[model samples]
Target: KGWGHGIKTTCVTRLDAFVSPEGKMYYHRCSVEEVIGRKLGPDDNLASAKNWARQQVLEGKDWRGKPAKFDPDARLFACLSQGEKEKLVEPGAFHVAVISARRGSGIV
Candidate 1:
């Protein structure tokens, strides 16, 4: 779902020509492992660490750069929109509706 009635997509910028020794590495994902006290496997999804690592790549582009794939501005905007949606809708309404639904019934 979008943030509003007409909002459809949030476009993030990407840098493909970046070059560095650690440009393609996800090293900061190690922080997530450190925080959780374990080493993550290749398939582990470290959402926060992933974003942070991408931001680091952008920064390593010879100057301070922003993470184009996970733009923090867009994140903040989406969060605000989600907060408004939460405020407007009853928190338990969806759960209540689910509990009230008939089980094993086909679409009517």
Candidate 2:
């Protein structure tokens, strides 16, 4: 269920933490590709690169991190609005499928 290999080339410069309305915390690790839509080069500045990554997410591009696999049923969840998604991920609503980028096989 995980992306076959690591696609990032820079260290995470910042972590964006989200607190669900119900009090759960989710931290998103920003990646270089998520920022610039490409891999990082040797000359890339870790600090500046991370800021760019953060901006992309803030701007609504879905470049959060490495790709992962999720339950097929999760597609239905996609129809949920952002507020609904937060509620579902709360302490209890139903089983939130484990989203992974390392599982090679399963009901992805």
Candidate 3:
């Protein structure tokens, strides 16, 4: 089972894409790994890395008002919207990777 904004108890077997509030596309890394039957190494692109970092900062806020750390395994890519094209391409637009998993659920 999965849980998040507009998502609940959902099953993701493939690389399901999700759009962030800032209009970025995030894909399930596990699903991608499953499809390719292999794990992915870091590509080390500056934009992608910055996007991931920014996302973490935005999503790291917990309900209890504590800073939370983002998951490392949730690989995501930013899909630049028309408005975000330039900003996303430039450096430092706050972001991070988030992955939701439930106890005993293989939905990660």
Q: Of the candidates shown, which would achieve the greatest lDDT relative to the real structure?
A: 2
lDDT of each: 0.42, 0.47, 0.47
| Residue 93 miss distance in model 2 (angstroms) | 6.4
Worst 10 residues of 1 by lDDT: 1-10
Candidate 2 Cα errors over 4 Å, as ranges = 1-43, 64-108
Model 3 lDDT tens row, 54-79 = 66567774423347766653433344
Clashes of each: 0, 3, 8
lDDT of 2 at 105: 65
- lDDT for residue 95 in candidate 1, whole number 0-100: 57
lDDT of 1 by residue, 1-108 (tens): 000011113425432222123333222445445655778566444454355455556575322343345467666556676667566655466653333355636553
Give the runs in model 3 whose Cα sits over 4 Å from its true position.
1-26, 44-108
Q: Poorest 10 consecutive residues of model 3 by lDDT?
A: 1-10
What's model 3's lDDT at 18?
39
State which candidate has the highest TM-score: 2
